[model samples]
Target: MLKTTSQVRALTPDDLPELHLLLDRDPLVNLFVRNRVDSTRLQARWLGGQVWGYFEDGVLVSACHAGTNLVPVQATRKALRAFAERVLGDNVRPSSIVGPRDAVLPLWELLEPRWGPARSPRLAQPFMVLDRDSRLTPDPRVRPVLIDEFDTIYPACVAMFTEEVGVDPEAGSRSGYRARVAQLISQGWAFAIIEDGQVLFKTEVGAATPQACQLQGVYVHPDLRGRGIAGPALSAVVRLVRQTVAPVVTLYVNDHNTPARRAYERVGFEHTETFASILL
Candidate 1:
């Protein structure tokens, strides 16, 4: 019943339902599904880009997506290696975000030998699920960030990216990282907690599918840490999502981020899986 590795190609319109079945059947990675992962988004990331699939007797079977360089270790490793060997005609590096518990070790096992130990960075990959009925008491200053706040919001995004991921947003400026924030704001997807007009806490839905909204780019100003700002900021975002659309929200945290994990538990997210990101 397994498909061979040769059928992988850019997703076509006919593959949508099958792709959904693949993602939904995955107990460990269901969080990858978001409302934004509609046909258009899926086309851009999985089809327009270099997504590959393995087919057996003309039926699609194993496939791996290479959008962010991170992937489910076991399912995609063989397929990914195939893509690297066949498609790229050389070994390639992929974008990686911290992954969940289940995929972590296997991914590490795959990446460590090739990239060597020093190239690997330890990350805590924690995912959180929300109970829609939960209500977080609001912070008086907490509110949805507005379009007009772009000037301030962009710098906050820059700081968070640089400090957490150690990347300069300036390199991608031409790609409109600022404009992305503005779009998130316009869609009521971004939030900020401010006191005396100074923003203190923030979070955004980094990626999404109909089944879940993923939290990413979460940051609290260092000065405001330990004051319980994240709870309110995150609560507001969850509230918005629960109120407007889906009943559940999910986020991944680094395993070492005890503070963040603790904060997420306070808001009602439970531990799910372990994942790893290896550079190969």
Candidate 2:
């Protein structure tokens, strides 16, 4: 009897159908990859990196999105090792590694020797999701950031980013980070509550698809923290997101963030999966 040999290779446009099927296996958890492929269709030129696929008997079983952010898609144990090996062989140094805890942790374990001393090795993050309207009343003050308020919202964006990622996004490229904030507002993806020209609360809808959308950069003004703001603010974001964006909303938070986790739970997000992130 012949055994099904396993192999890993860079996926191409011709492999998109199989890729879509793999992504569909869990749209909520795989939203990031789904959104990327939807826009780039697995094209390396457009993707800025390759989509590495693990094949068993010539059939794709798992995939990894290799770019500035390395993310795994439905990776099995063998697939995880294969991905790590493939990445190591190619000497890919992504800015961050993020995805399922089971997959990302193992994948990182394989790469850590060569890629040790990550800036932040967050081994456990709760991948929470919300499919229905938020339980709390949506804060009317929370709304899509207006394009004219770009200047007003820009500083808050930088603050949120720096605080969350532990790095100043503007350090690498001020214009680049500024442009991203503007783009989110222009797409109606940036949400915030502003009072007297001050940003009180803010968040952005990152990667999204028809099935699900993921949130990022959620923040409440430092002065406004510890005043029962997060729950209501997130409730507003979740409600607005479900209405205009996708029915399902998802976000992963560091496991140690008890306050944020409690806030998300109060707003109706339930932990459905575990995620891990290795920041470089």
* CA RMSD of each candidate after superposition: 3.5, 1.2
User: What are the TM-scores, per candidate, against the unseen true structure?
Assistant: 0.82, 0.97
Superposition TM-score, candidate 1 onto the true structure: 0.82
Alpha-carbon local distance difference test for all models: 0.62, 0.91
lDDT of 1 by residue, 1-280 (tens): 8644354565555776776666666533655532323635567744334445555566666555555454442355555445444434434455453444444455555555665663446554656677564466655565677888877777888898777665676775646677778777887777787566566888776666555667778889988799988886677778777665456687776678899998888777887655554433
- Number of the top candidate by TM-score? 2
lDDT at position 219, candidate 2: 89
Looking at model 2, residue 27 earns an lDDT score of 91
Cα-based lDDT at residue 10, candidate 1? 54
Candidate 2, which ten residues in sequence have the lowest lDDT sum? Answer: 107-116
**Can you tell me which runs of candidate 2 are displaced by over 4 Å?**
none
Q: What is the lDDT of residue 86 in candidate 2?
A: 85
Superposed by TM-score, candidate 1 places the C-alpha of residue 102 at a distance from the truth, in angstroms, of 4.0
